[model samples]
Target: MTDNALAYRRSHAFRTAVTDIGGHQRFTRAYRPQTNGKAERFNRTLAEEWAYAQPFTNSHERTAALPGFLHNYNHHRAHSALNGQPPITRLNNFAGH
Candidate 1:
């Protein structure tokens, strides 16, 4: 996915990686907050629920906790947007169907 960032446009490696994977980079339109609303909300939720949820002595410690937080968010925590189901639950249901 593409954002309105100059670094992404400047990086040839990033372009190559996405193209090689047969995934096209899609950019949100300027002045369209709705287009990226879900991503913005997810970021806020990550920060509030994990990154700033506790005090950390060092950056490494905070970063180390990210994987666990991600796992819980994806597999355990329920999301109202997905009808009160976790992301993994939705994915499993879809796969079964």
Candidate 2:
């Protein structure tokens, strides 16, 4: 699956990875937001809660902070749909314990 980012959509590396993985080349609907609803929602949450929560002087600082934000989001934040478990817990198959 791919987002609408121009760089991601057009990058040689991204295309090569998808092809190597046996994925077909298809584009998400241009104007239909529902086509990628899950990703859209995640992007919204990330932007509101992490990306735009504070002012960064430059892109470098924001990029540097992304790993910490992702780590915390995956390991600390609880999801109601996941029965209050962290994403990493589910991904690592340790949610029930």
Best by TM-score: 1
TM-score for all models, in order of appearance: 0.68, 0.63
Could you give me the TM-score of model 2 versus the true structure?
0.63
lDDT of 1 by residue, 2-74 (tens): 4667877788898888799576877767778886776678778988998899998999999899889988898
Question: What is the RMSD, in Å, between candidate 2 and the native fold over all Cα?
Answer: 5.5
Q: What's the lDDT for residue 57 in model 2?
A: 95
Deviating ranges (above 4 Å) for candidate 2: 1-10, 15-35, 92-97
Off by over 4 Å in 1: 12-32, 92-97
Output the worst ten-in-a-row residue range by lDDT, candidate 1.
Answer: 88-97
Model 1 steric clash pairs: none
Which predicted model would earn the best lDDT? 1
